[model samples]
Target chain A: MDYGEADRILTLLTREMGRISARAPGARRSQKRFAGRLDRFALVAVRLSGPPHRLTLLEAELEEPFLGLRDRLESSAAAAYVVEVSAALSPEGEAQPRIFGLVLEALAHLAEADGPPSPDLLRAFELKALDAAGLMPALDACAACGGPLAGEGIGFSPAGGGAVCPDHAAADPAASPLSPADVHHLRALARAPLGEPRADVGRAAHRRQASALRTFLDAQLGRRPRSAAFLEQVMET
Target chain B: MAEADPIRRLIHQLSRLPGVGEKTATRLAFHLLRADRAICLDLARALEEVSAQVGLCGRCANLAAIDPCPTCRDERRTDDTICVVERPQDQWALERAPEYRGRFHVLHGALDPLSGIGPEQLQIASLLHRLAPAAVREVILATNPTVEGEATALYLARLLKPLGVKVTRIAQGVALGSEIEYADQGTLSRALAHRHDFG
Candidate 1:
């Protein structure tokens, strides 16, 4: 975010420190200090001073600019959504090597992907990020009863934090019906490596999975990410 | 009450401006107090006139006192070209150079997905509508050199190219009077990639 005058308030998702906001004074005007390295999706090695919560960005060296992400609108939008979600999932002033790796892998995949990025790529990132945060929805068994999930009448509940069987579905009004096929797809997405393509599913199945992920994210984050709306707009166009 | 005091109220209002702290606001208030009464009254009148009259131009979305704005209504400017910028300030900066005599379109902001700004949030539809007249032969995207600005330019180019109208982006290179040794890597790389035969 742009701060007072030429300063910038940067939200950096670092491998060592997780997510941190540092004040980059004169970042907007002086490229000498920042060397034009503080752009979105650009990995940088930064030097900082001051206290932990109030760190001042002294200098930054651009490592991976991820320049290919700027080639297509879809790629850029996807990269934006991924970065925003990763920053949200990461805690402040803590090491989150897994989440950081997930984000970096996702960005690299998006940048190097041949065509329009698959929806599955983002789904995989979300699953991995949730897992890193210890909030991955239970898929193997019923979240409430911890029993085996039934083939029929299965629903995913954001509140319950996993797949709910028909017996527990009625208790949570917020639970959305999850078809067996959708569950299988979600499981596959959770297991698939980031950027790896999965079996192409029907549009309806994709919509359902997207909604489930959105609801789960909203429940966890207390609100939907702002970039998610932008992603939708970009994808629609 | 402290809120009821005129001097305190003036200081508070001044502090609301960007980059002005309370201490600076206090200094400004006292400076105005010692200034000529005519200057203070003129400043007040200017502020009131701006607040009451200034608004976005309906055609181009640039801030102006008139609906189509003076530039849009000017006959001297050609209808063959329209220069698009991210803000009114950018348009003003381009206007400082007298070489170009063309109309302008201001999107008000660049695409910033993280900030929730998208194509719908900008004045893109209006720009497309303006292009439908077939009078515009070319559109020059003059957004900033930032990543968001570059994305906005790319998006606009994709949308505008199919209309059969020519779309071009402003060139990026090292600034005039700046030493190449002192230039940043990004600027130097862009300059090298876009180098042309010297006259």
Candidate 2:
């Protein structure tokens, strides 16, 4: 959002600082300090000044502007979703290098990915992000009753934080049905490397997992991420 | 807060404007109180008339007193070329040069995912609609050289290229009168990367 005159208050997620807000004075009017480095998903190195509570952006060197992702609505939206998720999951002032690296890797893939951003890319990132945040949804067995999944069909319980057996699922209003194929795909997405051909579960399945993962994530976060709307619009259009 | 209601209300409203602090707002209110009644009335009327009379152009989306605006209605401007800008102010800045004879398209903003300004939020659909009817051959993207602006331009280029229209971006470099030593590394590097052939 626009701030006083040319200044911008930037919220950034980083390896050193999990999430931080810094004032970029004159960023909007002058191309000298921040210019292209301040946009979403741009990797930058910055010089900071001022006290710990009120850091100011002194200078920024753009590492990668992710210009490729900016070229298409779908790609940009997909990238935005991951960026929002990354920021939300990471707590401020606590360093988590793994999460930071994961975000950078995901963004780089989004920028270089050859088509309209693959839904699987986002799914994969979300899975890893959840794991990094120590919120990985239980998929190995039923989240309730401590029992292994018995059939080809199962139900996902967002509140339960994983898959639930049929008995519990029937009783739990929050449980949504998931096919064995979806379970397989979700497992693959949680651990598989991005762009792995093995993770190609077809577009319809991809869309299903995307919706499910998003719903589950929202439930976990207790608030719908802002980029979810943009992602939906981009995919729908 | 002021002791009087009118003065307090004026300061409150004035402070809502960008960059106007409480001190500045109070100072402006005091100044206005001492000014001639004619000046205050004229300022009020201008504000009212601007809101009532000024509207965005249907074609270019520029804020104007009439639909289509003078720029869109001008026959002398070529239909084959269109210069796209992030805001109406940018179009005016470009117009200061007077060398380009093409019409304009104002996006009102750039692609900023953080702030939720995307393709649908801008005047992109209108720009695309104008292209075919006008037989547009080339598009000059004059969006600011900022990150969002470049991204918006690239996004537009990708969208417009399949239509067989040529897409180009405005050149970014050191200002004409600026010294090389004063230019930032980003600008200098870009200038070197996008250097043009000289006679």
Candidate 3:
């Protein structure tokens, strides 16, 4: 969530960019000049000194941070989880701007009331994260036959990372099935604008996608994020 | 992230704390190792006890040994006043304030339709059961000020209103050390609504 506070510098690492820390001084503490600027959702402007070779510090700005996420614990938790992933996956002094942008986009969706970071917002984030990590699940062709995908969701392995058509699913009765709906839904969330959606039906559909993504990601990660338990304690009834 | 050693192993475990990282974890682990034997023993005993004895309270689902818990069993506290919260921490926070003298109900969690957590996942059934039997008057929802908290409060408010319980929200405000000058619109509004009479 980035919008108002333009001064605090956050060290962000993307799979693309080497470790990059940008400064938006007074982001959390400053107001008025950057009132409601550094929101927890969308992207914002940040100026940072690149490591070693790049001597001059340059000002960097973003489209926005997911702006509307402060009030809901679900959205907040999902967004926090994304940030945590970003922090963990990327190493020091490596900048991956594409992955950074992906995370920023995810944060923006999380900030919206109808954002993808709902209690079940797990799937979308996971899919996007995996994709950014070049860990995209096999959805297009069958993992077995390499044929085109069929149906709403296809049986797949989290270990393999994509859709396993019904025949392959039948062959491997115990294999994890990737929902086609879920895959496309995550793709949509990755591309959609970071604001409250106008329709409940669309939101509901997205929510379902997020839920499926959660299962898929947890399966892929094998280990859930430690924050998942605490965040669940706060959200689940 | 370094060569393995006893010191490093301890640091690794220490880093598991919610917010701790490599540096802080290293510092704390070393601190514990260097401390008095008795201190270490005390911690070991505490850990063992928590694992062995601590469990959810039967009445409130809070962590306690007793079945009904002291709070639930106390006769002096108003049984009619029920303070509802999402966790034991929230209940503790309310108890820390002297202004509230009512009894409490820990939901254990709020309503999060996502993550497959629904109404059945919570202690709502227990809460609903407690209502008709107890001489409860007001139900104060003390969930966090976050959106999920509000959504939960509102949902419960609707549910309990039909039961004839006076459901209320714990107003949001600038916390004790919060600067009034820097407070936002929503917080200010909440603070004003729940203003206490100092006189």
Candidate 4:
């Protein structure tokens, strides 16, 4: 975020630090210190100083800039959404090599993608991130009861923590209708490797899956990410 | 205290400006009080006049006293080429250089999705409206070389390319008077990647 005049308040997610916000003085105006190394989604190795309460960025070297992501709008928006989600899921000052690797892989895939990425890519990233954070929603069994989730009228409840059978669906008013196909797709996404390509799930199913994950994420984060809405706008346009 | 005293109120307002702390604001307030009355009065009048008269230009989003900004209204500049910039300050910086004589279109800001800044929040619709007449033959994207600025430029390029207009981005490289050895790695890498043959 832009701070007073030439300064910038940077929120960085690292493998060692997890997530930390630091003050970079003269980052906006001066070219010598930061020098385009602080671009969003760019992996940088930074040297920080000062007390633990308030760390100041002294130097930063760009590791993987992922410059290809800036070549198109869809890719850029997707990258932003991924980074926002990763940062939100990560805790402050904790080691999160898994999540850091997941984010780096996702961004690298998007950067090297042939065209605008499919919505499934985002869904896959969401599932993987949730898994990395140990918050993966209950997909195989009912969230309310450890019973099998089968039959029509199955609901996915963010409040109930995942897939809810028809019997427990009435308990949560916020539960949205989830089809068997969507449940299977979510399960497959959760289990699939990050680099593997998946078939398109069609537009309607994509919307349903995106909405389900969005509600689940909102419940986890306590609020929707601003970039999610922007991503929707860009995709629609 | 600020509500009761004009001096305190002035200091409070000045302190809200970027980079100005309460101490600096107080110092400035006392300095203004000790200075000539005409100088202080002139400064106040200038501020009031600017705040009252300066509004965004309808043609290009730059702040201007008139409907169309002076740059947009100038007959000497060509209408076929429009230089797109992120802010009015960027437009002014380009104006300092005498090489380009094209008109300008200001987007006010770039696309920063994380900050909730998207195409709808900017003057993108106005820019597209200006291009609908088919008068502009080329659009020079002069947005900053930052990530957000690059995203904005690329987003505009994607949208403008479908409209059949020639779209181009400003060159990125090392700054003049800067040593190559002292330049940062990212800048040097980009400079090398975008290198051209010398005359």
Whole-model lDDT values for every prediction: 0.86, 0.81, 0.62, 0.88
Residue-by-residue lDDT tens digits, candidate 2, B60-125: 999999897999899988888999999888898988988899889999999776667778999999
Question: How big is the positional error of residue B54 in model 1, measured in Å on the Cα after superposition?
Answer: 1.2
Q: After superposition, how far is residue A172 of candidate 3 from its true place, in Å?
A: 3.9
Chain A TM-score, structure 1: 0.94
Off by over 4 Å in 1: A29-31, A170-172, B188-199
Which of the predicted structures, 1 or 2, would earn the higher TM-score when compared with the native?
1
Candidate 3 TM-score restricted to chain A: 0.58
lDDT of 4: 0.88
Higher-scoring candidate on lDDT, 2 or 3: 2
Highest TM-score model number: 4
Worst 10 residues of 4 chain A by lDDT: A28-37
Q: Give the interface-residue alpha carbon RMSD of model 2.
A: 3.4
DockQ of 3: 0.06
User: Considering summed lDDT, which 10 consecutive residues are worst modelled in model 3 chain A?
Assistant: A1-10
The alpha-carbon deviation from the true structure for residue A144 of candidate 3, after best TM-score superposition, in angstroms, is 5.2
In the order shown, the candidates' Cα RMSDs to the true structure are 2.5, 3.3, 9.5, 2.2
**DockQ rank order:** 4, 1, 2, 3
Which lDDT tens digits does candidate 1 get at residues A176-216?
88887787788888887876767799777777788888888
Clashing residue pairs in candidate 2 (N, C-alpha, C atoms within 3 angstroms): none
Higher-scoring candidate on DockQ, 2 or 4: 4
Show where candidate 4 strays beyond 4 Å.
A170-173, B1-3, B197-199
